[model samples]
Target: MTEALLNVVGVSRSFSAGEDELTVLKEINLQINRGEMVAIIGASGSGKSTLMNILGCLDKPNKGHYFINGQDTSAMDENELAALRREYFGFIFQRYHLLGDLTALGNVEVPALYANEGPHERQKKATQLLTRLGLSDRLEHKPNQLSGGQQQRVSVARALINGGDVILADEPTGALDSTSGEEMMKLLRELHRDGHTIILVTHDPHIAEFADRVIEIKDGEIKDGEIIGDTRNDNVNAYQSSDRAATELVDNPPQTHPQTAKQQTTKYRINWSRYLEALKMALIGMSNNRLRTFLTMLGIIIGIASVVSVVALGAGSQQSIMANIASMGTNTIEIKPGTGRGDRRSGRIRTLMAADADALKTLSFVDSVTPTVRANVAIRYASETVTGSVQGVGTDYFRVRGYSLAQGQFFAEGNALGSVIFLGHLPVRVIGVTEPIESVSSNSDELNVWLPYTTVSGRIFRQNYVSDITVRVDENVESEVAEQGIISLLTMRHGTVDFFTINTDTIRKSIEKTSATMTMLISAIAFISLLVGGIGVMNIMLVSVTERTREIGIRIAVGARQTDIMRQFLIEAVLVCFCGGALGIGLAYFVGVIFSYSGSDFQMVYSGTSIIAAFACSTLIGVLFGYLPARNAARLNPIDALSRD
Candidate 1:
């Protein structure tokens, strides 16, 4: 007895129809032997197509069992069913069902792609199949570019790509003209002659005549309720009676055995080839919808740019501020009369004096010291009288303040007491002008006059005590340690703490802390935009999945695994975000260039770490937002997806 290649025993399929169950097929029993060309004829809505789908593993029956070559299909999982579809069966749809974006050869190679065939091998086989089907000149033509007959030929070629042990064709000639339909039937007969079990589903009686045995189905049940064919019969006589020319054309048809094709389904630990193919598909999808892809990336671009630019701006501003602070002299301390600035009696507590400066200079930790006395005065220089601040200081004041001379020299040790500018009523000679200091407290427009404390205290204010003292600490000592020493020495000398000291180092630390806090707060706010962008990606990808439902169906029908479908969409999403990240990084650098040209005191300083982090963040957003859409696409029912308009 001949073994049945495909067997269906007591199978029933039902669908939900608005609270009522609609049974499409009931108690269906059939058995198809190898190398037999059988035609299943039925009218529209007769469930013949559903039966074909079930037989091809595209749909499962709600009840009973289906077996393929003694292996029960009811026991197979989705992947296993997919493997069966890929290795054992090939479908030729009534509508041709070719992917519009792919060429004739490309469409033919899809099944082999899922079968884990190498690109070179699949392409060669696809080319050979198409050429043998009389489409040698149309290998690169897309489906839309071909005639009905040419497309059907390409569909036939695709069906044979993976050995196609059992060919389940659903109204394969329904869409073609009489001449094309005849050609397609003739081609099917040729395939049937080459040891293939061909199951043809059609409504036309004339088409049924081409099959060796005709099985008529009506209202989801076999006519007369029998299996309809003999247990075993030789199909050689049937092939010999076919048209001689068509059989001669496929005399040496590609010999791909079902068992050999089945062995190819044993996959590797990581199918890098499938991933690479998915990546290629992702690029093609992105290229085909350039505008939509870019629009989807817009939010990510703006978010990444904002985050990187804001961080760079914060870093740059902080650097500029620190530089200005450094101009005021590093590790410097100021001593002023009174306990603090808010003290009401600070002006009257004039215990801080020149002696304190001299005493601080004597300490090992003190690098230099200057006693300062200030008086606002009017000075006449060449008949131009300007009100200015006159500061009295020791000769080392300019050096301790980190001031460099612009044009004039500072006071000599001997001339400190002799040369001075004559203020409103005091007699003083103009000696020298120091360079402009770039400290935070120094204003470029403010006129400053410096003189010896001996001259200012004796000739002008006539006060024995200095207004304040400035001490530059040695580089070897920490500022806080030097501050403690100065406080203790001053307390002992004065018998009490009558003055307050301001450490520049402490001010630097506080300013740095504040700048960092503000940066983090702003960066966090910018990060919100990234989250919004990720949501946008998810929304767009969901819409894309809906739009490409038919495409997904086609891939699944052509033996694609759920993982394969998910991987392609996921890769596309990730590519969009990654490209957006690259563009965003470029935009940030461009913004930096624009900022530099604006003549600002500071330049934007980009960090390598921040740029890398931004790139990683964009990629993460892609994966996080893309998974939902990919999963939804992967989980779509193939039959429903194909039925969707």
Candidate 2:
């Protein structure tokens, strides 16, 4: 008189085996009314599991239609199928299908987690259900710590968590011992009497007799379909074994609001509580295998540390170079002559003259111009005969080159141009030292001998050619404008621009550019290591997915969408990498401090951008590489994963 809760018509299923097709279920039809206890009995490979898969909507029938609660399921999408499972069906596997990482209470709360229940409500319901199942004292025990009978009881409580009315049991008592199996059958019968529709698959006729109806399948076809009367003559009795517990469970019954609870859960969206719970479960999963988790994260840590350290060192080198350049003065420029254009044999340009120097001084932004002529000569200062290069320059050379005198006054201009050649090759004499010079070979001014331009040109070398010119630019004038003026005047005087080179704004910029380029190059090289780290992450995550196939299946059967599975795994990967990045930054900082305090010339520089970039890249690496494994996990067939050993 009432509509059947589930209906199947002309349903069939098949699989491809290399070159041939294998049909698992052929021309099968069945119907299950509400509150009816039905048994599907068959031998192995009889297509009973396939039919059950179709009935539970975990798989689709190839050539027929199936309807649940009067709605055809053949045309439904994945989201709708997931919703259907959550709203209507509950599953209990023979192996219990409990997540090993979660506690007994946590396992019972899983379906409710997907239901978007509040934490308090979910935990309360889980506690109540466990207490009813006689697992109150063992609520915190993990699956591996529980006995076979206790695990099955936990699965029963999980099935009923979302207020699902139909229970699909596939060989629920197959793995248990005689006593445990008997107790499980008694629990199923009690559930059936309490207005729950039960469909069980088993090969034992004794198990089938406990149901109100039995359908026997053989060779992918139904061979016998019979309705059995309840004789109530079985020795298995749940009431006798645990009468007090059964009475309490019946009275409380896990509080179902009937249509309203299912409706609310169906319309539910995931919130922070569910995400936090997933994270908590993932952490627990990782913590159980601590060594493996650390091994998986090691690659990421090394990669991040390498990147940060290299960049910091580069930044420090750049800073040191810039500081040295600043000490040489930013507003100074040096000019030199290029070699003869077509003839490389003439390396010196002898055309520079004093008249050209006078022309450069007339430029608007030119502060001072000094013509230089260098010649190595031996100076006999008492007993110390120091061989050094003498620079022929003017009084403005001291101001233009940022040189300060440590002792003795500079020679006046009157004696500078006097053509008095002192015998014994006294070309020029060292008048002062700029800073405390260490030795003649050190980079200092101790060996430098300065003399006036006119004296060296007319008296010492006996020639009028100048070697090079130095120009000091005004603070207000741009270097480009001043350089162009100098180049134009010198080219006009010489009638050729190729004979000379003009430099302005010192060598600081070139050296800075070189340091920056080197930093980028090292960082790029380090990035390769990061990419390798990413590959390592993907490899380990793939292995993890394979190792936890059964757990993934358990989540799917309880109404987790593909997105839910993807989100969980993605979060796990990001958490690992982000944490690794933080640790790497800390390591680098520690290394930097040690280097700075060791009294060495090497300095480690810390850049906020470098650390931030490393952090962001770590998270990005997780997303990029974690995708393949998460996708593989999400796309797995629920039935295949559930059946995985």
Query: Using lDDT as the measure, which candidate wins?
Result: 1
Stretches off by above 4 angstroms in model 2 are 220-275, 328-331, 334-433, 436-446, 449-506, 597-599
**Per-model C-alpha lDDT, please?**
0.84, 0.77
Per-residue lDDT for 1-645 in model 2, tens only? 756778888887889999998888777777777777788887888888888888888899888899876778988888778876765778988889999888999998888887778878989999998898899999999999999999999999999887657789999999999999999998988887766778899999889878877787877333322212223324433222223332232223233366677666655534565668667776887788777778777778888988999988988877776545544555666666664335463345677787777888888798888888778877666566767777789778776766556655566622333233332465344445554432212357546667788887878888887877888888678787787878788788888864544453646567778888888888888889888888898899899999999889888888888877887887778777887788878888888998889886669888899899999999999888888988988888999999898
Top candidate, metric TM-score: 1
* Backbone clash pairs in model 2 (N, Cα, C under 3 Å; residues 3+ apart or in different chains), count: 0
**Per-prediction TM-score:** 0.82, 0.75
RMSD of each: 6.1, 7.6
Q: Give the alpha carbon lDDT tens digit for every residue of 1-645 in model 1.
A: 745768899999889999998877778888877677888877887788888999989999999899887778899889888887887788899988898888999999999999888899999999999999989999999999999989988888888898887788999889999999998898988888877778999989888888887777776344422233332233425642233343232233224566554455544423878889999989888988999899889989988998999999999999998777766785689888898889899889978878788888889999889999998999865557789999899988887787776654677733433345468777566556556665645665788888899988988889999988888888678899999999999999999999998887877778889999999998998899988988999999999999999889988888999999999999989989999999988999999999999999999999999999999999999999999999999999999888877
The C-alpha stretches of model 1 lying farther than 4 A from their native spots are 220-270, 325-332, 336-396, 399-406, 409-420, 423-447, 452-468, 471-499, 504-525
TM-score of 2: 0.75
lDDT of 1 at 412: 78
